[model samples]
Target chain A: MKYTEEHEWLRIDGDVVVVGITEHAAEQLGDVVFVELPEIEAVVAKGDEVCVIESVKAASDILAPVDGEIVEVNEALSDNPGLVNEDPQGDAWFFKMKLDDLRVLDDFMTEDEYKDFLG
Target chain B: MSEHSTELKQTPLHALHLELGAKMVPFAGYSMPVQYPMGVMAEHLHTRAHAGLFDVSHMGQVILTPKHDMAALEAGLEALMPVAVSGLAEGRQRYGMFTNAQGGILDDLMFANRGDHLFMVVNAACKAEDIAHMKAHLADVAQVQPVTDRALLALQGPQAETALAALVPDVRAMRFMDVLSVDTLFGALWISRSGYTGEDGFEISVPATTVVDFARLLLDRPEVAAIGLGARDSLRLEAGLCLYGHDIDTGTSPVQAGLVWGIQKSRRTGGAREGGFPGADCILAELADGPAQLRVGLHPQTRAPMREGTEIWDASEGGQKIGCVTSGGFGPSLGAPIAMGYVDSGHASTGTPLWGEVRGKRLPVTVCDLPFRPSTYKR
Candidate 1:
């Protein structure tokens, strides 16, 4: 598992990168009520805001972890947005993308590094 | 009192909220629960259908008395507010606003005449500033004391009276805007027939020492469920009630905000037209003709809700930026997207064509009257 400073986590599943919010971020956001995801096939750059997550209190933007072409966007969030709050790491995957350069993962923190960063 | 930094203040019911798995957030410099595990939409719908118990201890409660003469205290309060304080009957409440010299509202507040004493409740965010402002102006004639340790709980819904009647029987007979002293399981409390949400409800003021016991007694009822600030905002929005700093501010007048009814009829017609209240001329004139910019309700053409700060344009005038949305959200009761904003009087009528620019796209909208959902307050 690789994590960004913005609290997004990405897991490489063969050629597709599964992305979702981290537990720490979801806890701070409180109850996740709505999620707006990018369209499939849309090209986004690293650090670009590509998604929005709204809780009861406020809304926050989720940034792209790497320059990539979107392969799959999570449609379940439109109906069951609470999945993000219930399971931020597992069933709440936001989108999958094909990385333009696989080396971008080098800049992300590992699970151990993220635990220390949170402390 | 507990190291007044930027940290959110916790009420006595904080532990109870957390135990209910409420989603907590910072509001008015306090760590408050915005919703419980049920979520905002569900909580809002439930409150309208049943009863919702809300923790409103964050609001500032204060007592005012005469330092010199009793008449002087009433005159001082009346000078600062638009309400006719002198005419208010004992055990009655009145809604009023503090205005600036330009006729803009500084803060909307509730004042109650408690026999020889006056009681008030101000918004959480504006409490400190309001107290300071009142002290600076009325210190010579009146004494202002802040009751920061008190706890305020609101039981709101159609069945609130029924649930509360079991504890305080007379609470059910209290008329709207009336305050009554009732005895409860915990102790004596001041129960007022008023609430922020446009529903039949009561706000109970209890001592800080026994607030927890009082809360637990109400929670024991199966008809009551704990609600948070999230549902509170959505409920009030559906009722077309204004939230300070969003719907009205130090720059918006009562007339523009559709609160002209709060201005007493005697004050409008009597010799008090040129009275020494702040911005009397501007407010009285606006009352006579109408404000240049009027607050109106909006119904978006699509399901996408238009949020605050979304620019509004007139399609007939080259899409000119005429005004901006102040408060907007989905009204579960109305089953549509509703909003309120300031617009030019020419384009403020119902059915006026308007557009809300969101995400570089113009969403078709129409100007409508307020309270998109009819109010069910037991008036």
Candidate 2:
């Protein structure tokens, strides 16, 4: 229920949403070879380009799932980018943003729904 | 993406790689692991600072034997290459290239004289064609046997020797470029104290059936970790090593690639050896003067990584197109962007201003001396 078709996941915490890549995206990328994060506190709109994730053979942009301001970034990725490939749903969360559109959650799939969609 | 219908070959460690969650991609007609859980940059830094293991089994390995006499085999090999192979010592390795009649390199290869036989390793992309070329030319003098079922693992890093010594004690005494037959925890293996990463390391060749177990044993060592093609590229880039297809191909000559050291002095001077090898006349001439275009290292000013096929412009020549970048990326160890490209000899000096045209925008760059990181081979 916290997943998007674009392979992004959102975890609601008060007014902020923590964002990260899904395990499927990580699997498709083969490895979390490199992560190019945006500057902290930068303002981003829904579906806007926020970050880049690169594997050896491919590079993809991580779009913002909801319009918000990036309040914090996972600085650990600068040294341990593989965390995204190892545990994308947990320690690999990209950043935290103050949500501007809670209605976007309705468009995302729940855990069970996402599993069915993947199948 | 282009789909290649060619059947992709797998190494002995293929199953193990998949079990460990390696992402496989087609490279040189083989399914190779490009990266693992650590990613490219981290693996690259680990290989430089610690030790990283790479599966390089796709590369071609061949054993050359004399059909009539050893002299004839040596002469036949020298006829196709520029290195002096006749006087090579047993258990020593020499880097060389096969050239066309016009002096352009056909393929870069490593030649090791192992007493009774001559051993060689070549680029995977050029292996089949290279073997066919040799078979067609030297069938009368030498017999080429392809060792397809073997596996090669490169253990590279600052602590590589220590980690390997714990497994194979005799490997500790092997000098740079020395090849030795040693016994390891797995079994007997052929190990060479040389690598492409410009570090103290060993490249071990083992039976295909036991490769996975051997790799697992190495990984068990606290200092050793599995690395993929991503780190392999960055490591070689920092070391100023050439990747055959990208940096030097059938169209480029060794002299132009700054690899003139591979040509022995004895092979160049003797009256009997004036012009025996393919393209000897053109190669010797270029060695005396210099190639028109030379491969040079570039240090870009911007953080953005310039990629292959990026055009290079001569700043002093009205920004004329002079060459193109062959390889470029961010070097984790060097902490900056580095690239290598062929430029006109006039603009090959260190600190010469050049331009790299990326996406219609020109990025300022400077020519710099190569081997951005000092080579730590135990010479």
Candidate 3:
């Protein structure tokens, strides 16, 4: 798993990858009451808003860290959006996508590097 | 009260908020906690189910005592507010507002008749100005004293009475809008059976020096959790209560804002104090003829929350903007997006469908009965 400056984490599973907001992002967002994800088979460019996270306080846009084609979305979140806060990096992932450019992964930060950057 | 907000002021519970891991935000010139570790949703639900203690010390408190007689003091206050203050019984409180000459709201406040004097609490953002306005207007009739020595706390929820009863027994006997002076372990406490969350609750006004320790004593109970301003806003919004600057402002009149209920019968037409307060001509006229626009509950059909300043358009009138959303957010209690906005009187019906423009996208919304959640006040 790697993190981006936009507070999104990418979990690589061979050629397919899963994406979700980071724990720090979830904590900052309070409790997410709604999640708006891009439709499956949608192609998103780097820095494009692929998802929106809404809270009672405010709404935030979650952008794609790299260009990719979305394959699946976590359907469970639509009914129980609080799952993002409970386990943002695991089962509560936003969407899965096949990486269009492998070079974008090199730009992400490692777990230790992201921890240091957050501090 | 300083114009320069570069350095934020801290409340009496600032250190405790930091200890509780609260997310601090700048609000009304103070660095106050917006939410705690429980997050807004859990905190709001907990407040509805159990007790939630809130540090409301940032709100302004003022004590107005008569220099002559009680009636004179009441009349003095009546000159500034639209509510019937002279008739308010002892240990009773009524919601009122400071109206401008054009029938606009300067600020809405809660004024309690304390037998010997009056206790008024105004919004924090406009407190300084409110104090100034009152002092300048009533300097001859009463002594306007701003309460600087007290810290206020709101213990609100279904179990608030049970939690507060452990500290003060008199609280159990009080009903909604009832006020009392009771003694507790820390010091003398003035309690009011009132809160913004539409729950059965109490507002405790205690000495500033001992407030932190006193609040900590209450937090020791399992039924109580410290809630922040974030949940406070949502809870009140769910109850259809207006936020000072957002829902009601200087440009909005009490009648247009759905606050005509606050003005007593005696203050209305054919009553003793009819047409006496500021902007009474316009207010009374609007009361009789109905306001051109009305503040109404807006339910956006979609789950996406429409925020403040979102424009509302007439669905059948070729997208004509009839009003704007003043307060909108996802309601934890309702499990959907709820909002309150001022709309054209023709479009303010309970079932009238409208359109809310959010980020340039039109979202379906309907006018519904206020208080998306029914009030559970222990009246």
Candidate 4:
């Protein structure tokens, strides 16, 4: 698993990368109320804001970590956005991205580096 | 720390807030808590269910003492605003606003008649200007002294009375908007059975020295929890209350803001005393003929929240721009997004379909009656 500077974590699945916000990000955004997911199979750039997250306090956007195509999204978030707060890095994974090269994940932060980045 | 953080003012309960693990943020030049460890959603639900204690000491408190008699001060004050301050009975509080020459609201305030003197609480951001305005206008008739040695705390919820009455048994007799000065173990508490939240509650003004102890006394009760500014905003939004600098501002008139009810008949056209306040011509004419735009509640059809600055359109795909949302967020109690904004008078009716432009998409919204939930104020 690797973490982006934007507090997003990516884990390599079979042929795709599962993307979700880190636990620190979920804790920062109090209670998640709504999540606007990107369309499946949409090509996204590294800086593209793919998802919008609304908490009781304010709204935040989830940026794509790397250039990829969205293959799958967590539809469960439509019924219960609070899952982001309950299990940010587990069941709350936002989407799966099919990247040309999974080697791009090596450029992201390690678990220990993410912890220091949070501090 | 940022230079702005160093300049931020601290409330009397600042230390206590840090002790409670509050995430402090800059609000109106004050270092205030936006939420505690419990978060905004939990605090909002807690306030609705049981009780929530709020530290509102950043708001300005002022005392206006008449130079000669109470009537003199009332007349001086009435000359500035449209409210009926002359007939405010002793130990009663009334909501008011300071108006500008253009009829725009300078600040919304709550003033209570304390027999010989009048006690007023105004918004923190507008405190300096509000004080100058009062002094410049009524210095001859009243002594406008801002109270700096007091802290204001709001205990609000369905169970607020039970927690407050436990501290001062006399609070049981007070109805909504009733104000009283009672002696307590902490200090002399100047309490009013009024609050920003629509719940039955009390706003207690205690000495700054003993305010921490007073807040602790209320928090000791199982029903009371420490609430923060984040939940306070959501609570007021759900209650359909206007927030200063948001729902109402220097450019928004009272009539357009749906605050005409605050103007008593005594100050209206064909009343006992009419048209003495600033911008009386514009305000009175709007009162009689109705404003071009009216502030109305907006209920988004989707789960996505249409926050402040979202444009309201007449059609789903941007046919014509109507107005804009002023205050909006996800309401915890309602489990949905709620908002209030100005719209053309023709589109102000309840159930009228409207569209709020969030991000780049036009989301369907409806003009709904204010107060997404029923207010539980004890009459």
DockQ leader:
4
Worst 10 residues of 1 chain B by lDDT: B266-275
Q: What are the clashing pairs of model 1?
A: none
Candidate 4 per-residue C-alpha lDDT over A24-94 given as tens digits, one digit per residue, 9 for 90 to 100: 99999989999999999999999999999999988999999999999999999989999999999899999
Q: What's the CA error at residue B63 for candidate 2, in Å? A: 0.4
* lDDT tens per residue, model 3, B196-227: 99888999999988899889978999999999
Instruction: Choose the strongest candidate by lDDT.
Output: 4
Please tell me the interface RMSD, in Å, for model 2.
4.3
lDDT (C-alpha) at residue B155 in model 2: 96
Per-residue alpha-carbon lDDT of model 4 for B203-265, expressed as tens digits?
999999999998998899999999999999999999999999999988889999999999999
Evaluation by TM-score, superior candidate among 2 and 4 = 4
In model 4, the Cα lDDT at residue B285 comes to 96
How do the residues B176-244 of candidate 2 rate in per-residue lDDT, one tens digit apiece? 999998766567798889999989999999989888988898899888889999889988988999999
In candidate 3 chain B, where is summed lDDT lowest over 10 consecutive residues?
Answer: B1-10
lDDT head-to-head 1 vs 4, winner = 4
Q: Tell me the tens digit of each residue's lDDT in model 1 across A2-95.
A: 9888999999999889999999998787666668789899999987889888665566889988889999988988677778988999999999
Model 2 B-chain TM: 0.96
DockQ of 2: 0.18
Of candidate 2 chain B, the 10-residue stretch with the lowest lDDT total is B266-275
lDDT preference between candidates 3 and 4, better one: 4
